[model samples]
Target: MEDPYEILGVKRDASTEEIRSAYRKLAKLHHPDLNPGKKEAEDRFKAVSAAYDLLSDPEKRGRFDRGEIDASGQERPPERQFYRDFGEGPGGQKYRAGAHFDQEDLSSIFEQAFRQRGGPGAGGHRSFNMRGADAHYGLSVSFLDAASGAKRRLTLPDGQMLDVNIPAGLQSGQVLRLAGKGMPGYGDGEAGDALIEITVEPHAFFERDGNNVRLILPVTLKEAVLGAKVEVPTVKGPVHLTIPPNSTSGTKLRLKGRGIRGADQYVELKVALPTEEEIELETFLKNWEPKHPFDPRKHMRGR
Candidate 1:
């Protein structure tokens, strides 16, 4: 294994927060869900995971820093050996070479050799029980799907289809964990979980701010000057809205419970005029002037 600092792209004297930030960045980048069927990215993900596993543990990190263990967790002396043998049978039949010991046999051998030294198998040789590997997946959702809460079908690594319920207001980068949905267990141990990361697509006309949805509505000059009932667009549908008499160009109007998840939000109205017809409208405006014209810049002359 390579150095944890190098894998995370941090300096050796980096703080815990810096290391954690780097790890999160790399984890999101090389995650298997983002890069499927890419062996290079998978290898990089494994390397990052291994580095984080070691550095996040205080005891293991101390031992590694003291040179007591190498990057792969082997002891300094590396107390492991391999032997091969080939011999002819009694009836002149040649025998092919093969591995001779299973995991249990190796465990027994190690237990006998290091029982007094308090190794991992000091308390007699026992069968290993390990959890399955955790699975990762990425899910893409539409803007409405994220806001309204929808159900989706997710296929597991073992060819199992799962029904996933996406919660309301689901944002990008949010992770959902499904228990016992990963690889199969080795023995009686439980299976690992499956993690799903969400990626919400951008909407053309709507934007979310916290739990509310924002939109810009365009209104004609006549609608702004004289009170009128006009149709306005909402996430649900279009509805009739009443514009106040003599409303300003930048007036904001509120449509209760029409935003995401029936949340309260406001729609800003911008008054627009037809540039080609402005000359004809100016002649009408000159003939019909209000008796009391309100000057918006009355209080700014002295300041």
Candidate 2:
């Protein structure tokens, strides 16, 4: 493990926004999907994620900066105690252990150390143990898939296929927790949880604002003037929309419950004229005028 700031390529005094920006840049560059079959990139992505997790947490970052904890968020042992237990021997020689380190046994030892040193709790009586590392996965969903909710499959680091049920109205950056699906536990501890982040792809014609979906629909000049039923696209499917007679180019129409749940759908009118017949239409309208031909911009003229 390395310093989180170093891992994220940020200064120790970097602002929250700067930290987040750096993390996002690094994460995207090293994401497994972007670097398929590249183990090094995957590892870097994990490191970047871990760094962001610690730095994003105010309490953890403060503790880390104050030397109260190590880069892995583990409590740092007292200088004197650490030296007494695992310091180098005379002549700069290191001591070798006879047996292999058992993870469960090591966890128990660390737990005992925490209890003895009054970790987390104020008093030394409370027992505290570290949870297994949390796992993170990025999920990509289509606009309709996000709106309608869908089941998605993710390949985890352990080569396991995890099925995630995305709920309706899910937004980008929303995290879904899958309990006991992360790193394996040590001793009798429970497994860590998985954190899946949502990323909805951009739609070709629809845009999301909060839970609302907005669309710009093109209508012919005749359709706008005469009023007609035109097909409009929605999250569900294409449906017929009525264009009111004399509707303006910027007029807005509403389709209730057609967007993501908890929001409404808005359709903005974009009146499109037939370019090929423009000359003929202009010539025909040369002598024609509106019955109430008032200057719409009259009020804007300077006195």
Instruction: List ranges where model 1 is wrong by over 4 Å.
Output: 1-109, 112-125, 133-140, 152-163, 199-202, 275-277, 286-288, 299-303
Q: Which stretches of candidate 2 lie over 4 Å from their true place?
A: 73-76, 81-129, 157-159, 277-279
Q: Which candidate number has the best lDDT? A: 2
Error of 1 at 267 (Å): 1.5
Task: For residues 167-268, write the lDDT of model 2, one tens digit per residue.
Answer: 987888888999998766554568878888788888899999888899999999889989999999998889888989999788999988888885778999
lDDT (Cα, tens digit) per residue for candidate 1, span 119-228: 35556444445566555566678888888789998644333577889998899879898899755676566897777778788887778887788877778888888878
Candidate 2 global TM-score: 0.77
lDDT of each: 0.71, 0.80
Model 1, residue 24: what's the lDDT?
69
Q: Against the hidden reference, what TM-scores do the models get?
A: 0.61, 0.77
Model 2 is weakest, by summed lDDT over 10 consecutive residues, at: 121-130
Q: RMSDs, each prediction?
A: 9.6, 6.5
